[model samples]
Target: MSSIGTGYDLGLFFSPDGRLFQAEYAYKAVENGSTCIGIKCQDGVILALEKIVISKLLKPRANPRIGSVGRHIGIATTGFIPDGKHIVKRARDEANSWRDNYGSAVPGPVMADRLGNYVQLFTCYSSVRPFGVMSFVAAYDDLGPHLYMIEPNGVYWGYNGISAGKGRQIARNELEKLDFSTLKMKDAVKEAARIIYATHDEEHNKEHEIEMTWVGEETNGIHTAVPDDLLQEAEAYARRTVEGGEDEDVPMNE
Candidate 1:
């Protein structure tokens, strides 16, 4: 018998096999999304997203995949972008609430935890569907730079490096080979660009753009878009590495 109309129809119910089918579907949605990568460097954190261009006529920069929370935190998302934006709005609200109540910027871990709880709420009620998105939150706080990934199921975890979407497995394998202890932030940026390029499926024949952001000493601990010159340089390097078959080479500091 097909279980399509049974427990899978609602996020509030679980199937006999101890699975939340709705949540699993939400995860599948994320897996099919555009790729996003997060790397925690010695001095800071990096967030990168592959923005698929649906139409050439679409205004450039009309929709950004990355957003800021307060002054110090930045978030990047994969999966349904509208759902991601909703989560961004909630994150900003939470940051504002924390600052208003405590007279301080919200910490990275606290922001991630609150957002996780908020996303999880959707799965608990029959009135709402699970968010079809996964988010990466990056921040530089008193404890230092932090990187976290929040899943659709409401779980979030701190990671040295993480990837989501269609190219996650390839991106993760590349991320694992890096030694962050000695890796500089600039190198991390180049590496982020490189991994994105490496994971791209040329056969898919889709137009795409790279969007990156960081929170670190270079930005004075503020979350902001990567500078155009630097970003362009990283993209160029990525292309060269991928085409020249030089994947093992580490980026040298300029």
Candidate 2:
């Protein structure tokens, strides 16, 4: 008989080898979700996601994977969308509470820590299961651009560039070659689009759309969706880079 079922029945129980099967399962859910990316550059932070379009009748941009939490903070999530939405709501609440108590917007690290604690609680109790989602939080604060990734296990970390979900490995490789200290927001947007386009699996994910948002100096530190004109331009550039076999020479400065 397999020992898989011996201790995997409950999230609160630990297997003989000390593995938390429930949390691992939650991570699998995230791995199966659409790809989401976050990058912190000199001028600002960018959040992007490849949204899998399930139906032709569905309205465009109806189910966005990226959302703004506060004036300067944005979140991109991948996994069970409902679970992701729950986290988004909690983040928004935390931001509002912080502003009410401190008379200023909540910082990125503080928000990530609070959310990490909240998510970690579910893994410790038997009554509730872990949240099936991984999220990236991006913000532009007084200290400059910040990017953080929160996992289903409640662990979180600050990153210059990070990617989650199906195409994470490919996206990570692409991000590793960039010079973040000099990377501008415009180039970051194009890079984001290129990464998403490169990672999309046509056989598995037939139809998809790119969702990108940013908080930067140009926007006066306000979080907002990438404008339609710029978004279209980035999409065009990304298509050329991916389809033209110019992956090795992606334009970083231009």
Query: lDDT scores for all predictions?
Result: 0.91, 0.90
User: Could you tally the backbone clashes for each prediction?
Assistant: 0, 0
TM-scores, each model vs. reference: 0.95, 0.94
User: Per-residue lDDT for 80-182 in model 2, tens only?
Assistant: 9999999999999999999999999999999999999999998999999999999899998899999999999999999999999999999999999899999
Clashing pairs in 2: none
RMSD of each: 1.9, 2.2
Segments in model 1 whose C-alpha atoms lie over 4 Å from true places? 1-8, 245-253
Score candidate 1 by lDDT: 0.91
lDDT of model 2 at residue 170?
Answer: 99
Candidate 2 similarity to native, TM-score:
0.94
Candidate 1 structure quality by residue, lDDT tens digits, 136-219: 999999899999999999999999999999999999999999998877788898999999999999997988889999999888
- The prediction achieving the highest lDDT against the true structure is 1
